[model samples]
Target: MAENDSFHHVLRGLGPQVEHRGEVIVIGLGRFGSSLGRTLVDMGHEVLGLDLDEQRVAEHSDSLTHVAEVDTTNVKALRQLGVGDATTVVVCIGADVESSVLTTAAVADLEVPNIWAKAMTEPHGRILARVGAHNVVFPEAEMGSRVAHLVTGGLLEYVALDDDFALVEMVAPDAIVGVPLGESNLRADHRVTIVCVKPSESGFTYADRDTVLDPSDIVVVAGHRSDLERFADR
Candidate 1:
């Protein structure tokens, strides 16, 4: 696999698993939307992708379960495309704030059980939320933060759980290398908990207090954002 695909695979593995197997409708076939649809399909879920741009629709036709060129802002178009039947609808028209908002509103009016939208800015996210989006994502900002964490050196990956908490994958700190987790006192000292450890060899295992940290091991840690930053800096 390509490096980007490998990275995405690792990231997905680190996230919580979903048990639901249902149809998903993704509106706006941009990079984010297309990736989401493809991932959902890879996870054994049926996906319907829609976009205003015929070129975009054509590009993903072979990859997605279904693809259609339709204006998501039109309630009639969405209904005709069976958007109301989807288990979830994701609006991912980040470049066009107007279209994104309108599409989200249209989906909301349909009262889809799950509605997710991507916003380009804080105000755009607020607008999407106001329009009844169950979740709003600021992809650019989130990516920037992830990159910043990696640039700090020991951190391999970072995922924000919320404004205050984060989950980070990083190399075992030198101070804790070769020490039993119980003796490391990371939780008491740094207010962080090691949830999983990935050895240099292969798969990850749940971390236990008796688990010994190898110098080459990568550990997934969860804690408040500030505490995580401090732990990483150490």
Candidate 2:
């Protein structure tokens, strides 16, 4: 790369040697990037969005703290755009695996402390990890699995803490309705713990052993995925 690499960009000055406390740089202003940048912006964090497409830069310019058109695969371009000073950088290039991997490699070369990359497949995730992406996310796969669980189980909300463990929100089942939770022996009988419960008329409160559940009430349960499924079914 030379001084005149032809990938001109309009970038905001990072100012001095200090990295902003709550700022993030997002590469590839596609759907994921736009959503993430806007979310960060909404959360009161300054987000810089970078992309190769001028249209993408223009479209997200008003939404993020700053938007720029730059070839992120070029390490020099990223450094010149002040990406090296970012505390966190995320590569959200979804379709083009080659560009995604190369961009991740470039960000790694910058030695940014935190690096996150989106991957379309397991192999892509492995490649990103090998190239120094500290966190590799399979968003589509995770979302699909979550939706599948929601569809199959009669759950109001299902959040997977990890591969095997999960937290779920569901209506109080007949098995536990009318029985005091402590005496119900749910933890011993079903292997699920009721963390909290919400009656129809009030907001949620912590569940204790003496808490008696009522029908039509909602409960938050934490347990292994398999146990949660069985408990939810009952």
Best by lDDT: 2
Candidate 2 per-residue lDDT over residues 1-234, each given as its tens digit: 542221111011111243446679999899998999999999999999999999999999889999889999999999998999889898999899999999999999999878888888877776877797877777798789889999998899988876689999999999999988888988889999999999999999999988989899999999999999999999
Flag clash pairs in model 1: none
Write candidate 1's Cα lDDT for 1-234 as tens digits.
Answer: 775443333322222233344788889888999999999999888899999999999999999999999988999989888887675888989998899999999998887877778888867776777787777777788899889988965788998876678899998988778988999889789899999999999789999978998889999999998898888887
Q: Mind sharing the TM-score for model 1?
A: 0.87
- TM-scores of the models, in the order given: 0.87, 0.87
| Cα displacement (Å) at residue 230, model 1 | 2.4
Error of 1 at 2 (Å): 45
- Which stretches in model 2 have alpha-carbon errors above 4 Å? 1-20
Candidate 1: where are CA atoms >4 Å away?
1-21
User: Where is the poorest 10-residue window by lDDT in model 2?
Assistant: 6-15
lDDT of 2 at 120: 89
